[model samples]
Structures are given as structure tokens and as C-alpha cells.
Target: MLPEGNEMYRSTYEAKKAFKAMGSGYTKIHACVNNCILYRKEYTDMVACATCGKSRWKVVEQKNKIYNNIPAKCLWYLPIITRFKRLFQSKTTAKDLTWHATERMVDVGVLSHPADSPAWAAINDKYPDFASELRNLRLGISANGVDVNRGNRSHSVWPVLTVIYNLPPWLCMKRKFIMLSLLISGTPGNDIDVLLAPLIDDLQLLFDFGVETYNAYAQEHFKLHVVVLWTINDYPALGTLSGCPYSGFQGCAVCGEDTHCINSLNRISRVMMVIEDFYHMITRSEDKRSKEIIVDELDKLQEELCVTLCLLDKHFPPSVFDVMIHLTVHLTREVKLCGPIFFRWMYPFERYMKVIKGNVRNKNRPEECIAEKNVAEETIEFFSQFLKRVDNVDIPPNNHNNCGIHKGVDSSSITDGTPISAAKLVEVSAELFSKAHFFVLQNTSEVLPYIKRHMEFLEHIHPTKQNAHLEQEHSRERELGACRETITETMRWISHGPNKNIIKYDVYAINGYTFRTKAREGKVYQNSGVSVVATDTHISKEVVTYAKNTYYGVLQEIWVLDYHFKRIPIFMCDWVDNRKGVKRDKFGYTLVELKRLGHKGDPFILASQAQQVFYVTDPLDQKMSIVFKTPPKNYKDTYEDVDEEFSTIVPHNDNILPRVDTLDLQKENDYFRNDCHEGKGQNLSTSLCGE
Candidate 1:
């Protein structure tokens, strides 16, 4: 039968007994108060309270009424009894009686023996007088008569009272037996509600303690965050705190109000601490339960960390451009190495520059007239100075030399007698420097002799021959020919006698020929003056066309002359004379037959033909026209035979023109007629040929 304490236990025990008495082989009974208990006919089957030896019949009705009235009361000591019963049944031996007694008193309405009720008697017998004396013990008395003060002298006794009052009446009944067992066996607080109450309170206390601890931790850990917020809230406090030893632990000096500096540090520390704790906890856990607890703690810590970071961001102001730059450098190198964090740190600087650029574009703002420009200039200067320091750095061998010009001294020149000149040194340095450095120097250096030399070399090596030829040709036609013609025409016009009126000779083109004559004034032509000018109008189109044609003609002649003079034959053959002759027979007779058959009639004619054949020469008529001829043997016979011919012909041409009357009149008439048809006869034959 089951052990009895509370109503549930009593009912369960009675049911077990009834079951046993009925001769049912199924004597195993499961009790709601305790756990399942096994009973054999050979073992004891009666139900009795282990605490007071109260019979199950006496307590059963009271236990049922208590169980019906308060179900939670049944649960108070039921677990303890159930655990003990299960133990006894499993072992089939007498279990520790302390657990059973504790369950019984806590379950049923029972109290400890009189000796254990010292505080009870004081409360029951002394009443108001004892309560007044207890209040004088310096313990703070609550309105409900409970001592709330932890420092009270009677504080130790308070727990006993609390246990009794808090437990159900059924549970109090077994208190003496439970206390005895507890003293002997060292089992404490076997009542389920009593044990669980303090644990639940402690859990709440731990939570509160954690909060306080976190606040203190935040003060130390998030100093930067706190300082930055303080600075932003009370700007003057920044200067006051500036003297503090922990001042450097605050925001950036340049952009002090901005929180990026401190936030970066806080985030880094938090993430690192969390990761470290996670690893420590997981590694140190002894079992799955402990590991799970640790994991849960870590999860909570992570959530707290996230909340902290978010709060830091919300409270802290953004950094300025200058501050961002400093923050990025400091945070990346010293605080945090996260890529996203670095980018966030740099974004402010980029945005600031963009804003500055926009402000510069706004013309209405006179105050910012040069502000944007000045800032840009300063930024450039700053970068330039920074680059100077970077350039001075001696790069490691493995590092790429990005300097445009290598600044390192030439080892090759060290072996030479003379030290390399600065100019040559720069040149040599340029070869070793990186492309980035080279271009940077190229832009910055005002007098870069190396660059000048490089440009010169490029020009010299790749000269434009075709363009040079074109320029030369243009110079001869425009400057030389035009100037010479203008000067000569002016001189000629001046040499001629002037009239009373000042003459103006306007040189112009009539068709394709250049003409110079006096300008008409009041129906009279002027002389002794000439003016020359270039015009784009079609009035001078013919002259330009003629000039162009003449230029091209001269160019062609030069080419032809060069070709002919430079040409040579590959081979030559010896001269040979024709020696073969054939005799022709006249209709009269053959020569050999004529000798044999010489007749007197044809003898006179034949004899005369033979005698006067030498004198029978035809009369030759000769006419001479002016022709150029070179002196014999004056021309040299070389590979370029025609070159010699050109030299001969050119020099002789001055005297080769026809003398008036001897010129072929018919030929001149034909030329004049052709020129007339071409509308040039009047101008050419009359003015030039003196027709």
C-alpha cells in the first residue's frame, strides 16, 4: 500500500489496500500523490502516515475534501512522496524516511512538535506584546506584520515561519517528523513549493543583477559612446573632459561631435568579447545541459550586444569628412578591421567633398566665394604632402615601386668615375618608378627636363616628311613668288613717268593671267602706282588656278628631269656597218650585158650617165631658225646622261628666241589664231608677242 500524507496520498493508499484485499493479482498501484508502488501479499499492505502513524481511514475524508478544495495544495508535497515511493518500490527496501515525512506534513495539515514551535508559541501566547517586542528588534515591520529587514536579529527564524505559513495545512502536520529526518539524514526543503519558490526568486534576482552589472560594464566598455553623447549634449563638457586621462577614449578631435570614432571601437570590442565568450563557454561545458545553458546565455549576450550597438548608433551623431578620414585610419589600424565598417567610415568624407563641390557651383553665395575653392586646394595640398611622405618611404623589395620616377640612387653610376648629374639621375629614377608615381610627378613637376627630352626624341625619330614637303612647296608659292611679283611690279610701275593725277595700278587677274595696269579715275587710267592684295572672290579664281597649275607643272618637270638624268642603260653593243650591196637593172639593160651589147644609139646616153654621175648632185636648200645647241664634248657620259643634257640645254635657252623677221609668219599666224579662239589672242599676241 502507498504511504499516506495528503488527501491524494490517502486516497491512493486506500485504493491500493482495497485492491490487495480483493485478491486481485494486479497489486501494483499508481498513486497521484507519490509514484507507482508495487505491493506483494508477502509485504506489508496497510496504509499509514510515516510521520504520525495516522491511519489512512482517519485522513482519507479530510484529504479528499482538501484535494477537492485546493488542487494546487495536493501538488505541494506530492512530488517528494512520489519520488520516495518510487525509490522504495524500485529497491524493495526501506527508503530514506525523511523524504516521506517531509511530503506527509507538507501534503496533510500537520505541524512540527512543540519543541520546534518556539516562534509559533511566541506568536500564539504573547500575541500583541511579543509582536511589539519583535518590532523593537530593529527589523523593519511591514504593514502585514512580516519582517522585511535582512539585518534583523530574528531573521534566521523567519524562514521557518515562512515555510510553515506558505505550505498547505496538510503539509504543516508532518513538519516535526520531516524536521527530524532532515536533521538526521541532511535532506532539506523536500516540499516542492518550498524548494521552487526561492529558486524562482533567485532567478528574478539574477536577472536584476545582470542588468545592474551590464550598466556598470557599459560605463567602462562604452566610454567612447558615453563621452561622445556627453559632448554632443553639452558641447562644453568636451573641453572639460579633454583634460581627463580618458579623453583620448572619446570621439575624434577634428570631428568630435561625430560618433563613428567611438562606435567603431565599441563594436569591435563587443564582437571580439562575444566570440571569445562563446568559444570559452562551449569549450568548457561538461554536458549537453550545461552546453545548452551556455549556448542560451551566449544567444542572450549576442542580443544584448546588438541592442547596445544599435543604441550607440542612435545616440551618436555622424562624423564629418575630416573626422571620418581620421576615424577610418584610426579604426582600421587600431580598433576594427571590418570592410563594411571601413566603408561606412569613409562615406562621410566622400559625401562632404560632393557637398563642397555643389556649394562651389552655387554663384549666389558670396560668403562661400572662395571657400569651396580653398577647401579643394587644401585637400589637394594635403594629398600632395601625404604623397611626398609616401614617396620618401623606402619600399620593400617585394613591393611594387609605384613612383613615376625612381628616387633611389643608381648603383650602376656608383661604379663610374663621375657622379651622375641630377638630370640624368631623374631620368634613371623614372625608369624604376611605377606608372602612378610617374604620372603624378609628370603633372606636378613644372620643369620636367626628362619629359621634355622624351617628347623631343619622339618628334625627331618620327618626323613627318610628307608634311614638310607640303609646307616647303606652299612657302615657295605664297611667300617667295607672291612677294617677288608684288615688288617687281611696284618697281616697274614707279619707274614709268607719272601724270599730274596720282595713278593707282591695281594688279589683278583677267581670266587666268596676272595683269598690271593703272586704275581708271574719272574716265582716265592712272599709272605709276600698284597695289596687291589676296581675295577669296571668284574675281581672282582664274589667277589662283593658273598659279596652281604652274606650280604642279614645275613639280612634274622636276620629277621628269630627275628620272631622265638619273637613268642608265644596262648594257651596250659595238657599232656595225652594212656591207652587202645589190645591183639594180634599169629598163634599158643590165650593166654586164650592156658592155657586151653596146649599141651606138644608147652608147651616147650610157656614156654620158656614167661620165656625169658624180656631178649629177641635187641642189640643197637650207633655212635657219633659232635653235639651242650644246657645245660638243661639253656633256659628260655617266649613268645619268640626261642630267648633263639638262645642264647644257638650260644655259643655252636665253639666246634661243627668234629674231623678228626670220620668225615663221605662218606659224605665228596659226598660234595667234589658236590663241584668238581661246580668247587669249588679243592679250597675248598684242602685249607679249608685240603682234
Candidate 2:
């Protein structure tokens, strides 16, 4: 209840509810009419925008500008601290908030998770103190601008979102789980760090002095430590956030990994600079001199990053010379290791942005609309924890999908790939039933025993050698069209060429296994012998690794033969490699990308022996990456020596980075630059940061 002196809100039920539902952590700060800093805290007393010298407040006849009322613009921040606290309130989700600590498999040099990557390990080693808190919260800060104005180009809205990595994957990208933490109002601008100053300040405080909060489930209070694992964005946003060239000859956020493109003949002549073999120094020999050389070469790659920055064409904006490529990576170093590039990326947020845009009806005040929607969504999500659902999964379940574990073994499991309810193996759903029956037959030796048990169960119901009625439709069709009209007797036993038997029936009236919450996929066909693994299934047999290598199979049995009692699970897969020979099921074939993931088209893997392949099954996931080896001698370096004044003169397609950079940026125009530079549109008219 509010005090009697309070005039803004009354002590009433509606008012109290409104106050409770309100997202008021945001600070209303004034900004320059011309794109500049959002005047706040230290700049609160300042009368004008620091860069443009424009008055911070609007002149009005109604009343003198009050900090509480409408200022020049509003930067709505739903305090991250508050959001972090709420993450632990829900009993169901509270357990997931510490997944990174509880379940991240590490130490074996596997790139399966960010927690296992080299980047994560280094960060922990670097900051033992911060890493000491087993429950320290981790996050992926993702931001991108979306055209919320239908398809209008002139106006745009960029919402800065943060995903709590502490929570498991299912909730990480869900609209209800994401935090609409900061809303940078108006059309896109390059001054991100300026807008992010407040958020960063709060983050700094959270890092230094963690908030003390009681975990309702744990029943004890502990300091809630947090760290922004990494920032996620596309190339242009990465450039804007890091303050570096993201296109042109100099455009590469990772310093040396920029994809080089040749300038068209009509454009400026492009110069492709060759790089020296830093590898030779690091690997050619292991002597003291070679080690020092390796260190020097490493230093050169990191050299101010200015050498690479200086190589950009002069026509490029001065910001192109700022070599602060991927500055957000410093967080990785502090934490030890961040893992692969895609892990802490904005793809999830970019997708979730659709939900943010869907919430907007009136585009006039986009930030306000997003704020209201985010709070409401979060509240609904919090309450939904107390309810039950028959549909989509509410928890992250992965224990049901490894080795030969399927229905009958663990019948409660359900996978996404499989249908939800128990599909009975019958004539109408014949293909589905056949697939399952074959999986049980081909993968496991227990198929016969199970079929025997099944037959015994069936004899109790009705003793008969006929699902003869099931073949009636087929016989009728042949009689209607065929000249000879031969009535072939169907072998009712589990039929596989010459494999049908009297006791082992082909059609088992059984429930198709449900693995709705399993890994890789859900819903096993009867026995879950149908495992769709990647083409590289030969290497690691893990169907979950790469989609292209995936093919459905009946995982038959686990065999431990010669390799000193090693358990090996083998599959009788339907290979996409060859349909000409003994290949059984031909839905699709192997897809292989030399350097990419998605298929270019059908017949992805161009194997010459594709048609000759006969054996389709093998030990699954048996060939996963088990060794880290050095490159062969044939590995060549693309390089040449560089001078201080050397400029990489190359004309490239301007299709990159939605916006380009300018010298002044004082005039509001379409240009995007990296956020690594210290000043506005940094100008390096004379020198390129002293490389």
C-alpha cells in the first residue's frame, strides 16, 4: 500500500496490481537530436548532448521538463538483476538454471558443448575466483535490428535481448524465456556502447558485488554471481558492437579469418595479400628457437590487429582502421574458454525477434510496446510452470536416446520425430508398422523372443494364422487388373525375404514406442530400431551430430566382440548412398558439404560407388573424432610481407553489411561501424593506430 501523501498511485487493488506487474527498472534519459549518447547518471546534470550541443530537454508550454515525465527519449531497461532473480523463483525452471555446472561434460577434449570447448577452460583458469562460484550465472547477450514497420526502410527498431545460458536450451530461445532487456529507440545507429552504458554499468556491479538472493528450492540464500558469456549478432551487428571493419578488404571480426573476395573487373583492382606460414614456426620444429618463432608468429597475428586494419583501402571509413576486432572475446578470456563460434550466437534471438515483432500493433512507440509484451510474456511463462500440458515438452529430457534404449526397455520416453500417442501396428498404418517391425527384426536378436512373447499374447486373444484379411485389398486390386491374376499367399510371420517363421509373426499388434522427451529425435517405431544418423555415422554413429549424415535405420543389437569387451551397438540402416543394390528404404541419400552444412540439392554426397553399396548397417557413432592431429606437409600458407603503409586495395561487392560507415556520423545517415573504437566514427586521417 502507498502512503496517503502519494499522489501518483492510489492505495487500491487495481493500483497495487499495476505496480506489481510494472517493469519500471528502465531509466528515462535525454539524448541529442542528432544521434549521440543517452544523457544519464554522470551526464544527468548536463544541459545538452555532448557531441551535437543540442538541448537535452524539449521546451513545452505545459510544464518545465521533469526527469520523471517524458524526456527526449526513453531507454526501457527491465533490470537484468530483477530478471535473473525471477529465473530462480519457478520450481520447475530453478533446477535448469544451474545446468552448465551440474551436467556440462568436460575434460575429454570434446566440442559437444561450450562448457567442454577450449575457450571455456581457459576462462576458468584465468579467473579462479569468479569460477569458484559453481552457480555463477552465464548469459549470451544477443541484439539485432529488425524492420518492425512492415517493410519500411526509413524506420527501424533494434531490440537488445539477453538469453540466460544457465537455463537449458528449450527455454533459451522461447519467446517467454528471453529478456527484452534493452530497447535502443529509433532508426539504427553505430553508437551501441553509448546506449549500452547503463546495462554495462549494472553488469559491472553484478560481477563485482553479486546480489544476495534466496533460492526457494535450495532454501538458502547465496550471492548470485553472473557473467555475460558472449554477445551474439550477425556480421554487421558484430562489427557495430566490436568497432571494426566487417566488409571490404579489412572486413573481418576475427582478425585473420575474413573471407576474401575478388573485385569485379569493372571495379577497383583487388589485391589479395598472401599470409606467411605461421604454422611452420608453431609446428615445423619443437626446439627453443622454433618455440620463440612460434610465439612471434602468434604475436604478429595479434599484432595490434592494426597491421590488418591498416591494410584496408583508404576510401573506407576511418573506423575501418580500428583493429578492435571481436572485443567481446575478452569476456571469453576472462571466463577461460567460450567454445565454437556458433554456440554463443544470435541465431536464437534473431528467430525470437519474430515474437517481439508480433507483439507490436502500434509502431509509433515500439520500445514501449516491446516492454509491455516482454513483461506479460514472462509473467505468463512463470505462471505456466504451475500448470500441466499434453502437447509440447516442458522439460529438457535426454536420457532416453543412447545405445539400444527404446520402448519396452523404457516405454515412458517420447521423441519429437515420432508421433505422440501409441500407434498400433495395423494394416491402415502399414508403412509405419512395417518400419517398426523391421527395426525390431533387423536391429535386435531379441526380435524373435519378443515376437514369440507377442505371439503367445495374441494366441490368448484369438488363435489364427491370418492377417489374411489385411491382404484382401491387394489381392482384389491384382484380380481387377492383372492378366494371370495369381493369388499369392502372404507369409504372416515377421517377413524379411526368406526369414518368415511360424511362431514369429510379421505384424505385431503393439504400440509404437513414444520417446517424446528423448535426444536426437522422438517417438521410436515399436522398438526404436529406426535410428536416423548422419552419413558420418561411420565415424561416431551419433545421428545427432550432423543432419546431412542422417539416415533412418533399425538399430539391431549391441555386440561386444574382439576389442577387449567394448560394447558396440550396430544399426541395419537404410542407406541413401545406393538404392540400386540391396538398399532397403530409399527416402533420401547422404548429404555432404565440403565446407557448409545444408544441402545444395539432392544427391549431396557424390560417391562413385554409391550405386554399388550393399551393406547398409554398421556400428553407429563408432567413428566420432577421437584424435587431434597436425596437418600434412602439403598444407600451404597464403601470405606475403607487409609494410607499415601497406593498404589492402580490393574492390568487393557492397552487398555485405546492410549499412556502410561515414567519417562524421554527425548527420543521421545509413552507415554501420564496429563499436570497438573509443570515439564517434573514429577518423584515422594520418595514421592507422600505430601498427
Best by lDDT: 2
Q: TM-score of model 1 relative to the true fold?
A: 0.11
Per-residue lDDT over 548-576 for candidate 1, one digit per residue giving the tens place of the 0 to 100 score: 10000000000000011121000000111
The Cα local distance difference test for each model comes to 0.23, 0.44
How much is the lDDT of residue 508 in candidate 2? Answer: 15
Q: Could you tell me which 10 consecutive residues in candidate 1 have the lowest summed lDDT?
A: 550-559
After TM-score superposition, what is the CA distance of residue 580 in candidate 2 from its true location, in Å?
3.1
**Which regions in candidate 1 have their CA more than 4 angstroms from the true location?**
1-75, 79-691
Model 2 vs. true fold: TM: 0.50
